[model samples]
Target: MEKLDVLVLLDVSGLEDKEKFEKHLKKEGFHTVPDEAFVYTAESSTTTFSTKAYILEVFKKGLQKNTFLDANLIFLLNETPYPAYYYDKNSNDFELSESKEAI
Candidate 1:
């Protein structure tokens, strides 16, 4: 379904990890936008799942780009190519997680 605006893409439904991420972002004084976005993603043509894509931008950058980044955190999952956690301050770069376990 069409993403509920670009800001709502960060909504992680009811996942506890998502909640913790949200709280952590807020604790860091970062402003997060809710982006409950879903894309009909397909892998190998036959495998597909309506997965969620989330992004966060610092308040300053969000104002310039009209998008926000998840300040000090990113929504993580095990299926992706990199570790499930990371810290990305630069809006245009992807920084992978350093620890194997969530700290």
Candidate 2:
């Protein structure tokens, strides 16, 4: 299994209750990063795909609860950052688009 560091950056400015959003992320096994970011460690055979799936699931749940408005999710594999997905307000879901070079 490959271990990767997953980071979820959420813009909760539009959320009616920011605490509810934070609680939801914590309940889903994400750790707070002092600011609004959430972090997690994911082990998977296909780190890229697994990270994308995880982000999609989070986006789905957030959309259902109207807690997540916009967000960007990324995973670091061997310290190389890769974007998994991003929430688009127009689509109301995660969109996989061209991402910047892995850092």
Candidate 3:
């Protein structure tokens, strides 16, 4: 399998502890991008689970711990301009509502 590129968009505007949140993401191996986006690329051979799924799990746990509050996240696979799964804060879960054909 090919490496999958993941992008996580965090809403940090007006948050007092934004730096701490950013640090947490970086500690988890995400690189910062412009506009509150953090990125990570996963090599398929190195991990047993799907890259997107793993990232989502990380985000979910982070959210539960208030690491990313008032934030909505989306997972984009392989550098695509669209999201494969979006985090639903109300439900605290990732929803795969995007069409694969869009990729």
Q: Can you write out model 2's per-residue Cα lDDT over 1-103, one digit (the tens) per residue?
A: 6566565554334556656655666676666676434444433345567656775686457555755445665555556665556567787766765665322
Q: Estimate each model's TM-score.
A: 0.26, 0.61, 0.56
lDDT ranking from best candidate downward: 2, 3, 1
Taking the tens digit of each residue's C-alpha lDDT, what string does model 1 give over 1-103? 2322211222222332444444444553434543432211221211113122223233223323333434223332223432333435464544445765432
Displacement of residue 40 (Cα, Å) in model 1 is: 6.5
Candidates in order: C-alpha RMSD to true structure: 11.8, 3.7, 4.5
Off by over 4 Å in 3: 11-16, 34-49, 67-69, 81-90, 96-103
Question: Candidate 2 at 68: error in angstroms?
Answer: 6.1
- Cα deviation at 47, candidate 3, in Å, is 7.3
Weakest lDDT window of 10 consecutive positions for candidate 3: 39-48
Of 1 and 3, the candidate ranking higher by TM-score: 3
Query: How many collisions between residues are there in candidate 2?
Result: 0
Runs in model 2 with CA error above 4 Å? 36-46, 67-78, 97-103
